[model samples]
Target: MSKAPNNQWWRGGVIYQIYPRSFADSNGDGVGDLPGITARLQHVADLGADALWLSPIFKSPMKDFGYDVSDYCDIDPMFGTLEDFRTLVQHAHALGLKVMIDQVLSHTSDQHPWFAQSRASRDNPRADWYVWADAKDDGNPPNNWLSVFGGSAWQWDTRRRQYYLHNFLSSQPDLNFHNPEVVRALLETVKFWLDLGVDGYRLDTAPFYFHDQQLRDNPGRGKATSGDAAFPDVNPYTWQRHIYDKERPENIGFLQQLRALVDQYPDTTMVGEIGTDDSIATMAEYTRGDDRLHMAYSFDLLGADWSSPFLHNLLQRFADKSRGGWPSWALSNHDVPRVGSRWGGPDCNPKLLRLAAVLQMTLRGSPCLYQGDELGLPEAEVAYEDLQDPYGITMWPEFKGRDGCRTPMPWDSTAVDLGFGNHSPKAWLPITGAYRKLAVNLQQRDPDSMLHFYRQLLHWRRSQPVLIKGEQSLLPVHPQVLAYVREHAGERVLCALNFSDRPATLNLPTGLQAAAVLDLPGLQGGRLQGGELAFEAFGGLLLSLA
Candidate 1:
């Protein structure tokens, strides 16, 4: 059973995001399972993370990986039984780590019994449980809404001869939040996990919980294209403003109710994933009050723009807009490619990786570290034939999908399959690229390995109280340097990061004094003195101000 409530544990906490399908394989089934995760709980706790967020592990059709949940209450057989999940949760809690599971309440797999019953006939009790609309005069879709995966958001259901809304894959039908019954049912499902002792939920596409009742047409973006989006060049879903499709005003009341339920289990949190065009603002709005989300994360840091000027402006924008809400920052997740490859390139620079890790963990909000990021693993190069992601299959060549990042974790460098499993036919996804060299076993022995750098940074971060709940203020924006001062209880800590490959210097302003240079293990070659700070390439400075 969970211990006494500690509601404030999530504030500035370090959450390690684990992609369950790749973390470990205990059954020799090639695919990872709950037992695999339970066996590896010590790894997360040893890395000094306060919590772990498991990607969706519910019963699913595997169309969109585990994002398309079929059953809200049970674990999939492939991942083992509910007992297995219980064991994983118990083991995690024993290791002093909170467990957060992905909650896919916005939609359900077409294979769900509810969807099957609702589509059987219009007069069924659950007919309105999903967003079903009649075709327009031209027998076309109800509106111009497009699925985030591809083509139309509405699929014609031959049973009712009407269109059902699907913001993602066609197999995943959107739920109708307009129905009070639907809202109640979803909350009941969430309560199941709470009663089961999971710490919280990582709400998938949170803003998408409610959609416009009138089914209005989404307006197209006048000039914007998909150059810097999650799906670039291939997906047209980013061409529109996405106003009516998601982030409706009705969501606030629903979120409040959800929060109320989670609050009952004290210390439990709900961190929403906001992915609309205006994600930062939506994140702030969703988490503005204690009655809504406990915290929320946007795709702001998950993008390609890592320039100091860009980061400085982004932080300022978030600080300016966020009134009292909390945020969770993640540079990479199962959805995006590894930051090492995205930011550092094919043969990623471990120094830059260490620098990025420090920057993320030192940010104002709770930082979520994705699996393999601690090892500085670059994105794997999976062949087209080996691709399993439908998102990539739909938009091949230009965008090869998320399979590159979903490959199995490298546990041992000497093993033929990297020690993921023994007696298995083959790993679900090949352990390709140079990931073997960066395996956990190899890094465990190397004192200066990127893995060790993460352990050092995370362990040290826990000792700093000011970094936890401090008020963040940006320094004067520098073209190549991102700097901020976090103040709490009359104490101030300055964090300055150099985003350039070349050495950089910044002269401190009048009235500011660097009382002492704080020791940040793993991030080397940075000094602060004489009101003039100097940083080596991709270096950082953590100091106390006098």
Candidate 2:
């Protein structure tokens, strides 16, 4: 029931990611669901985002907290019903927002009917639906593939009389994409959603779609050696080169197929999550042509790297390699610590948050804004006893799971549980102490708040053609400064960021007359006369040169 728009807004647009479980709760169930999200779509639309990227809401056992989907076409009982999802789509469209749901094609929960049937016995009709193989001579796993959740990638299946491959937890088995039937079934599932009028999809764990058919052992990779990336490492999946286990060239065909499926519907688009260690390269590859993903995102910027040179180099590397493909940039997500907490440190300048918003909007590709980011929410501290994530529980202390980023949204400072729901029952992942002070209600009244800055910055970005459709060039990197130029049809803009904690002097190239200056924090006030640009600590300046 979408009143179709005249144009596809995904290209160079901003997408707001809403992790449903933590977004809002209408039923006072202490968990956000479809109804809660529908009610909040206006907030996203008002923020000037063009689309909404909702994480998985499919039926699941919640083993991986909805990442391990049990049913592709039906809504989880905990999340509501299919009718609720349809209502969400309609509401989002009426407000000029495109809805994109996460599609986890690489694997499914062991609880899925298909996986259950496949694992029932070796000769079951759906036996080939999941990845199965014989053990090596020494009775070890069939190959060296590492699970991101920890331990060996292969788990013995008593019913199948062999081992099944799992790139994550043993509870989530990898799908055998090599089987044509499997491909068709997954496509049908996608078609089911499309028929229900979804505007797009966000493919999860996109790189691991296809595995080595030979079940060959993965070569040792990137400073680690030994079995399946096992315990005590970052997600356990990083230990291997991952060349064989993921990022296979064959994945391009499936991407083409998925793209073809999307093409059947006008204006529908797909953005994939490439979680590979070499994510930039995979992102560039997956989105290289119109036949594949419309755009792809990687974790290159989501980590805790805040140095100016690092950001400059990362942008340069992506631009250098992604000549044909489009890139989608994200500063935070449900799986990582909020950028304010990760990068802002003890004294997070509100100005820097404003500058970050400006930078994201002005970047060359479509930007993704995670929920709670507009309020400048930092990472929450979760005690071990309060932990729920399998990934976090598996590796305690060394690497806490994603619960820090998945806390419920703080709407009011005085409201109990920060007004997340009307429940007297305790809510999961208690709202952080620091976040209570920065709640949306508090910021709405403060014109100079981070929320206001985001609103103003986004409004400003929309009017500038140079920002929306500009070609970017990284300027020479100085010690604590990073500069870049954006050129559109005829306009030229020079943007600079100062990453140091102390005031810094920037010597601009000669012959450029500074026409207008945007006063962003981390940048001190300076008259742009002559060719020199001076900045204060952590200041960022956007200049129009004539």
Which model scores highest in TM-score? 1
Best by lDDT: 1
lDDT of candidate 1 over 1-546, digit per residue (tens): 233465689999999999888888888888988899898889899999999999999999889878898899999888889999999988898889999999999999999999999999999999999999999999999999999888999999999999999999999999999999999999999999999999999999898988988888988985566444465655888888889999999989999888888888878888999887777788889999678998999877887779999888878877778898899999999888889888888766677888888888888899999998888888889889999998888888888889988899888888877877774538788876477788899999999888888998899989888888888888999977788998889999999999989899998877778889898887776887678999998888988998
What would the C-alpha RMSD of candidate 1 be, to one decimal place?
1.9
- Candidate 1 collision pairs: none
Question: Each model's TM-score, in the order given?
Answer: 0.98, 0.94
- Superposed Cα deviation of residue 125, candidate 1 (Å): 0.5
Over the stretch 1-546, how does candidate 2's per-residue lDDT look in tens digits? 222332556878889999998888888878888998898888888888888999999999999888998998899988899999999999999998999999999999999999989999888889999999988899888777778777898999877679999988899999999999999999999999989988899889888999989877776656552221122345545656777888888999999998888888878889998776567777888889678998998877777666788888888888878876788988888877788877786677766666567667778888999999999987888999999898889888888888998989988788777867774336767766677888888988988777777777776777877877789988887888778888888789988777777777787776666788864432343345457777777667789968
Q: Residue 335 in candidate 1 has what lDDT?
A: 86
Q: lDDT for every model?
A: 0.88, 0.82
| Candidate 2 TM-score to native | 0.94
